[model samples]
Every structure is written in structure tokens, then in C-alpha cells.
Target: MNAPRKLWLWHVPLILLSAIMLLPLWWMVVAAFDPMHALIGGHLTLWPVTWNLKNFVAAWRSQPFGRYYVNSIATTIGIVTLQILTSSLAAYALAFLTFRGKRIIWGMTLLAMMIPVQAIFIPDYLILSQLNWINTYQALILPFAASAFGIFWLHQAFRNVPRALVEAMMMDGASPLTILWQLILPNTRPAVITLAVLNTVFHYGYLFWPLLVTNTAAYRVLPLGLSYFVAQQSGFMQWNLMMAAVLMTVLPMMVLFALAQRYLRAGVMHYGIRG
Candidate 1:
């Protein structure tokens, strides 16, 4: 077979795998539109028995999903923006600059990465509580202003950049910040996008931190909102409604992933190339 024809043939398995991976999402779509009775019938089926968009409307009206969306979007955006700034600058310093305690600081960062967020939740919560930031956007966004993982990810990408290129820019009178912004960051675009998309998805779906910090609706995020909805429907959840709410909760991340799909693969490949 010719090279192009063979390449086309290779896509068949990938297409099939993609469909397989999408099955649960497809099931959710079918369930979201299925009438409550149809969903509760306990029959195994892949298709919706009937078309009913009311599940979506009912789900929305039953909860303050719009407000939840606003809270989630605002906090997630804040966290991501601050994270990129902190990560890029810290990573640049670690990768290209020399200073006192550099190894010790890098060691600390690596140690921080090994420590899970759950392990630090109590301290984080106490810090927020002490600041009287409970239920505020500050409580939600401040703790994540600097991400250990983000710093590590960008640092790896930065190290892959040739030191000579950075020096050349410096020789021409470029400031470190200028070289970082105008040169290094552009070359590491995939890594940045990959981190942004990942961060968005995580923060958008995060339940535990928001649940711990915020008790009021004003700061409630999507996952916490969904839990409340589930609680409200505990005894007999309308499966269709549940599916609709979940779909709404995850829709943003889905769109984000779809848009950044190419960058994710490229980022992984780029990181793996030299590391």
C-alpha cells in the first residue's frame, strides 16, 4: 500500500478506540434526554426511549446552577491566571538563573510535589480561616495562586530550551523577563496550554476545597452544587435530571479539552523528547 493509504488504514483502530472511550458520554447524552420513567425502568439500553429536554430545564430550575457557573468560572480563571504567572516565573528562575539555595529550593519544590493537597488541606483551611476569607473568592483562589505541579511542568520545558539561545538574547540587551516572555514562552506554548487546560478542568470540577472553605451559595462551585442537587433528590433521583446536571457541570471542561486536544498530545511528546 502507498504511504498515505497505509496511514489512513492506521486511523481505523484509533477511531474505534475513540468511540469506545466516548461510550459513557454517549450514554449520558441518551440518559439526559430519556424521560424519568424510561431511565428508571431498569432496562439495559443504549438509546433514549423518548426526547425530553425538560430534564435539563427542570435540573437548572431546581438549583442555582447559573450562579454556580459564575462562581466556578471566576475562581477557576483566577487560579489559572495566577498559576501561569507564578509557574512561568518560578520555572524560568529555576531553569536559567543562578542564586543562593537553588538546589535546596528545587528540592523543596520536588518535596512539595510529593505532598498531596489533601494532606495540606487542614493547614490551608486554617490559614484561610485565620484570614477571615471563608466563602470569599480569595479563599478559593489564593491557595492555588502558585501551583507546585505547574512550576515543575514549566521548569522541565524550560530546561529543554538551549541555554545558548537565552544567552544570545541577553547579549543583545534583552531583559530576563523579555527573553522569558518573548522567546522561551513562545517555544513552550504547548506546555503552557496543556497546563492551563488541565488546571481549568481540575479547578472547575473540584469539590473538596470549595466544600471545605465555602458554606454559602455565593461561593459554591459546580461540583459542590451538583452534590447538593444529588442530596435534594436522594431517595429517588430522576436519573435523567441527574444526567442533565452532570452534563452541564462537565460541559465547559469538555469544550476546553476538545479545543486543546492537539496541544495535550504535542505537550506530552515535547516533554518526553528530552526528559
Candidate 2:
């Protein structure tokens, strides 16, 4: 085959796959803006016949979504910030510092990563309950502040740093914290940003933990708010309104990924090269 022809053939499959993945999202956009009468009349189409703002307005007014947005944003930011700090520090220590039982500690972290969150939920819940943290922001943010996966990911990135640079820093009497913030983190900008973006996306969609810890609207996040909205439509499904809410819930992460796509690509490349 000619080179151009081969390249086109290779790209065809990827293009198809991309379209397949985006089909649902495109449908969501269509459904979100389609008029409720059209939707209820079973007049579904790939493109909206009638586009209006009614769905968005109705979805927003149907529930306390404003509060949900605030709670979700706050908790997600808090979790991602704390995860970066704790993970980077733990990773730096594991990768650079020579300490007793370093292997054991690293092994434990790996084990923690392997264990499912469900397996430890009882213990985590009990600890929070004893501390009287239920139905509070602390319960939502504290349990996930440190992530074993984050530690492992940053540890790998940290190991990619030049050993000579670290040794020279140490010789100049640079403290561990200084080395971490000044050298290691700066060098791993792509990885750190990638982790932050991924963590934010994951925690923003997190429903199970928030559901278990919070019972009131004051602490309810977006995912739970969506659930409540769905449940309220017990017999009849408000597909248009529901999809509008889903779109709003996911729009931020979509914008984030679009903006940081380059960094995400670079981070993935670094991981493959380093590993």
C-alpha cells in the first residue's frame, strides 16, 4: 500500500472509535435543548428540532442545584489540593530519602492501592463517626485527602529526576521540602498537572462516599443532587431535564480536559518513557 493510503486506513478506525464514544455526548446535547413536548411525544432525533433554554431553567429551578454546585466545587478543590501535597511529599520521601522500613512503607502503599475502597469503608466510617464528622465537609474531604495511587504516580515521576541533581541539592544543605518544591515538583510539572486534573475529574463525579457520609442538602454534592432529581421523577422520566442537569454537571471537566489536553498527553508520554 502507498504511504498515504496506509495512513488513512490506520486513522479510519480511530476516527470511527472517537465518533462512537462521542455519540452519547452528542445525544445528550440534543436532548438537553430539545423541547419537552417534542421529547415527550417520542420525536427524538440526532439533532434537536426545537432548541430552547427551558430545559436548563427548569432543571436549575427543580432542585437546589446552586448549593450542590458550591459543595461539589469546594470539596473537589479541597481533595485535589490536599492529595497533591500529601502525595508529592510521600513520593519524594519514598523516592529520595533513605529511611528505616522504606520498602515496607512503599509496599504498604501499594497494598493500599490494591485494596478496594469498599473493603475499608466500614472502618473509615467508624472513625469518622467517632469523630462526629458525619454529614459534614470534613467527612467528604478528609477520607480522600491522601491517595495511594497519587503517591505511586508521583513516586514514579520523582524517580525520573536526575540523581546527580538531587545529590548536589543535598550537598548544598537544601532541606527535603526545599528540594521537593524547588526541583522535583518543577521538573514534573506535566505529571503533577495531569494528576491534579484527573483527581478533580474523579472526585467531582464521586457519589458513593458523599452519599454515605451526608444525608442533608447542606452537604449534598452534584452527584447526589442528580440522584435526588432522578428519584423525584419516580414514574415519568424527565429525559430532557435530566440530560440538561448531566450536561451542567460534566461541562467543567470537559472544558478542563480540553484546556489541559496537551499536558495530559505529555504526562502520559513521560510515564511510558520513564516506566
Candidate 3:
């Protein structure tokens, strides 16, 4: 085959694969507007002859999606804020502080990462229940405030800070706390933002633990509220509304990731470079 023809042939399969991957999302956009057709129905509607905004409106009206949205935002933001604070402080200690049993403390922190989140669910539940936090926002945010992954990530980033820079700060009569807050933290902006964005994306879709912990719709996040569409009634199975709900739930984090793609890449690169 000629060069152009060979190139076309190679591109053909890629084009087909792209279409295959996008088919569901395309159908979702179509389905979100077509209220008459259910998502799993035999007759697939390639395009809606009539585009109506009712499905989106109805999905919100059917349940308090707005409240669920607010809850999700609050939980995600709260969790990220606390994680950044705690993880940065802890990572600073692990990276710079010299103290008794420091290695053992760091070892325990690493060990925490090895323990699967699911395994701790029962204990976490018991603790939250004892605190009467099962149906509260604290139940959603407090437990995840200190993330092992965030600590480890920041630890690596903090290591990249030159020792001379810290010493310079110290020689200038700056305290260790001042060095950490003023020098190290500012230099680690990319790593911090990357972890915050990653954590928000992760916790946004955290369904199992949230569902287990929060029973009331008042404190329910988007994932739990989206599931309500499945559990409530046969009519709610209409794919259009469900897809609309899914898009509504997913779009924020998707946009966030898209915007911060470079920072995330830089964080990973810095980790490798320092290692």
C-alpha cells in the first residue's frame, strides 16, 4: 500500500475505537433529552427528534439534587482542606523534624496505607456511631480528613526541598515552623494542588462508605442521591434523567481534572526526578 493509504488504514481502526468509546456518552446525551425512551430499552434512539429540558428539570425536581449537590461540595471541600492541613504538617515532620521514634512514626503512617479502606469500615462506622455522627456531615468529612496518600505524596514533595534552603531559613533566625510554612509549603504548591484535586476527584465518587454512613437524604451526597433514582420507582429508570444526573454529578471533577492536568503531571514528574 502507498504511504497515504497505509496511514488511512491505521487511522481507520483508531477512529472506530474512538467512536466505540464515545457511543455510550453520545447515547447518554441523546437519552438525557428523550423522556419517552428508557435507557435500556430495545429501541435505541440515535437522536431525539425533540430536545426538551424537562428531564434535567424533572431530575432535580424528583429529588433534592440541589441539596445533595451542596452536601457533596461541602464534604469534598472540607475533606480536602483538612487533608492538606494535616498531611502537610505531618509530611513536614517526616521530612525535616528530628525526634524520638520518628522512623517508627513514619513507618506506622506508611503501614496505614497498606490497610485497605474497606477493612476499616466497620471500625470507622462504630467510631462514628459512637460519636452520633452517622447522619451528620462530620461522618462524611472527619474520617477522611487525614489521608495516607496525601501524606506520602507531600512527604516526597517536601523531600525535594533543598536542605540548604531550610538551613538558610534557620540561620536567619527563623523557627522550624516558620521554615515549613513560609518556605517549604510555598515551594510545594504544585504537589499540594495536585493532591487536593486528586482527593476531591476521589471522594466525589466515594459511594460505599458514604451510603453506609449516611442514611438521611439531608446529608446525602450526589452518589447516594443518584442511587436513589435506581431504588425509587420504575419511572425513574428513564435513562435521560439518569444520564443527566450522572453528568451533573461528574462534570465538576471532570472540569477540575481537565484544568489541573498539567499540575498533576508535574507532581508525578517531580516525584520521579527527586527519587
239-270: candidate 1 lDDT, tens digit per residue: 78888999999888888888888998897777
- Give model 1 RMSD, 1 decimal: 3.1
Candidate 2's residue-wise lDDT over 1-275, tens digit each? 64664676878899999999999999899889987543456555788778898999999999999999999999999999999999999999999999999999999999889987778888999999999999999999999999999999999999989999999999999999999989999999999998998789889999999988999999999999999999999877878899999999988889999999999899877774543
Q: List the residue pairs that clash in candidate 2.
A: none
Q: Name model 3 segments beyond 4 Å from true.
A: 1-10, 39-41, 272-275
Candidate lDDT (C-alpha), each: 0.88, 0.91, 0.85
The C-alpha local distance difference test score for the whole of candidate 3 amounts to 0.85
TM-score of each: 0.89, 0.92, 0.89
Worst 10 residues of 1 by lDDT: 36-45
Model 2: per-residue Cα lDDT at residue 182: 94
> What C-alpha lDDT, on a 0 to 100 scale, does residue 20 get in candidate 2?
100
lDDT of 3 by residue, 1-275 (tens): 54664676788899999999999888878877776756446775888867888888988898899999999999999999999999998998899878899889888888998897798899899999999888999999999988887788899989989988988887899987799889998998888877887788889889988998998889999999999876776644567778878778877987898999899898757664542
